[model samples]
Target: MRIAQVCAVVSTLLFTVVAFADVKPNQLFSDHAVLQGGMSVPVWGTADPGEKVVVSFAKQRKVTTADADGKWRVKLGKLTVGGPFVMTITGKNTVTINDVLVGEDWIGSGQSNMAFTVSAKVAAFAGMQDEDKEIAAANYPQLRIFMATTKKTYEPQSEISGEWKIATPENAPAFSAVAYLFGRDLNQALREPVGMVVVAFGASTAESWVSRPVAAGDPQIKTMLDHFDDLYSFYKTHPNATTDQAPSAPQTINARPGKPGPLRDPVQDQHQPTVLYNGMVHPIIPFAMRGVIWYQGESIVGGKAGVAIYPHVMEALVKDWRQEWGEGNFPFYCVQLPPLKNSSNNPMVREGQAHLLSLPDTGMAVTLDVGDPTNVHPKNKEPVGDRLSRIALANVYGKKIEFSGPVLAGMQIEGANIVLHFSHAAGLIGKGGPLQWFQVAGADGRYVSAMAIIRGEAVVVHSDEVVSPVSVRYAWDNYPDGANLINGAGLPAAPFRTDSQDALSAIAKDFTGK
Candidate 1:
């Protein structure tokens, strides 16, 4: 009996070791997950060398063999918009994922506002407006969230640390406020399940999201890279220097249990070069998402080059993400930088965001009026979410609703007055008071405040100081407080300028040479 007991203990130890070394699926493929519907779902993992793997989900099954490196994948056929399905993956051992739903999936990526949770309290941060109320009322099961854990790496990471959770009053407080509101509105409008994977970092730069190879290859982006390299060299040795902090502290993005340390080389942190995309964005690729919504650029905005290079960075990101996902022309939307009391050229960034509409299948959510001049992270998040949902509803879902504000279409000098033509100009009028923030400039190019009133479908402006109105600017400053031009749909018109030789635009040209 003693000899038999010893043999049994040895056998149990060996079995446990083999079990731990067998095939494993990503945590994202686990229970309570939402897969993107209407697309080929990719199931992947690793196993023993040359192991035959089979993945079965819904009514479809696929088989593939693990490579020499133990990596394997199988692509399930396109699925419809409905599921409470179970997925089974079998190799030497079997792994089963349960209670998975199939529906719309989107990625929300950007800076602090994108990272701003309905409830976050820590350094370099503040909580969302009415945080407690928003958290207590949350009870949506279909609006699932998969928040990618923060990990800044110099090289691309294959796996991230996080799990999907159903939105509840308990868990919703930690979810991204904009993402939650957007997903809530989306689910309500589509009447289907919606999931958002937020991979945002506070105080991150645009260059950080673009890969080094891509940035090095592009002339315009390379300029920004060179400047960052020079600045980081100074910041690393001079620890107390006034440089932007790393992309984020691990605890800031998620309320992790233990305190985390800063990067070994602060210069190569997530805020620098391609650190963000390498660490945060890469681990999440090929997840099969519907589209993306972005809200960032505050850290990258500058006087001239910052604005000019912004459009290029936007183009790089759009191209890079689409290339990574292998999805064709997915909808990309972003929120414009709202008004702020800080003395910076935020309008330049806003204009660059507006210019992104020139890209195929891209949209912008104007929030000029929705901003709090005193606060960067505005408390009014519902409107921002609703506006984003409006764009998706009208453009992607085929809903017949006015999704955009009055877009500047053309400018005409109608003898001593500048007449502005607009798209979606129906019911164009100032709200709360008379029209404000309109300025007209003459040949000498000096702008004086002007009187603007709606004339039929256009806004006509005139000023006593200018004889010939060559250019017109509306709400064209860091904080245009009373700029309240909205369309009939009540969406505010984006801040704009009608001059080709404007100082900001000219400075941008000097840097970008475009």
Candidate 2:
């Protein structure tokens, strides 16, 4: 009996060693966990070819075999999102992931400004004293945050590492301030446990988020492809690159003398393609998201250059994301670029941003009235997040409240004056305070300050100096600090340019076909 027991122990030890050596947990529960409501959930894993694998989640079992190249996956059927669950994936060995929750998942993306941190924007927090009380008293044990750890690779990454963290004062502040603020409001407003997957890099153009094959295929996007090649190549070469060594956070473009070189080396900026998408976004495409909130475009805006191609880029990104996730036309909301400091009265970037609204079921949250003239990183994120919530409430969740400020619809030429019609003017009043940042230009194409009066559903604009007004503009400064033209609901109208004497168009035509 003693000899038999010793032989059995030796056999067990050998089996354990062989299993450990042969098994690898190369994939993860994707960054964005799909919410399962009354349906079978698909939980997947990857391993060596022909390797038998088992996934256990929520009292269900799924079995699959790895392909010839050592890859495997499985789907568990019909599980709900009410979980403090653990998923154990076993093949030759066993790997267990704990504290997994099923809930609504969202994608927070865009440029550097979107990637801005809460601690970096100190003032944005000061206004949220009431929110602070709520954050301090937070007890939602089910809420989880999956930060898409930043990476750059030429090929899609098989795995990424980040764990679920409960929202505490210590952990919550480091979260994307915009994403967290938005998530907090949604979690409270909807009363459903929310999970956010932040997959943004600062200073990234819309093109960076798009796949190379998709961008290269579009005629309008080909120009941008040439520009992003080098940036992409750099990302592919340096997968673990970061901006912490620079003066700012993940997204700031630091071209200062002391700054590390561009995210990619300067010499390769035009040589490589799909670097950022491969390294940063490719690995994220498989994760499912309910919707996306984007905050970018500050990096890619050159007035004329922005206008001709930005809309196409927006379309490409939307289409690409939908294709990757296999979800059709999910809600996509974005923050319009705020006011800035240029003497010109015809701002094209804002127009480019507004143009994205032409796409179906998309919303733009304007910040014309909320930005500082010199500070590009605006401190007021609460209103930005709140405005976004209104969209989710109205368009996504189907609530009917006044969610927008005034939006420019069109204008009519009435003799010497231009009558501007606006949407979202249901409860507009202009008597108590000043209505500012209106400009009118004549046939000579020179814009001068004009007196604007809130005339019923339209703003009638005219300048005495220019009798035959060919063009009119509102809140058109690069950074219109005093852009006070907001509705009673406090949402700002995005900056705009009419077809009337568009200077930037002429400039773009000059550069096109060159």
Q: How much is the lDDT of residue 482 in candidate 1?
A: 85
The weakest ten consecutive residues by lDDT in model 2 span 505-514
RMSD of 1: 6.7
Clashes of each: 0, 20
Shift in Å, residue 264, candidate 2: 5.7
Model 1 residue runs over 4 Å out of place are 1-20, 121-124, 223-264, 301-303, 501-514
Candidate 2 wrong stretches, greater than 4 Å = 1-42, 75-81, 121-139, 223-273, 301-303, 342-346, 500-514
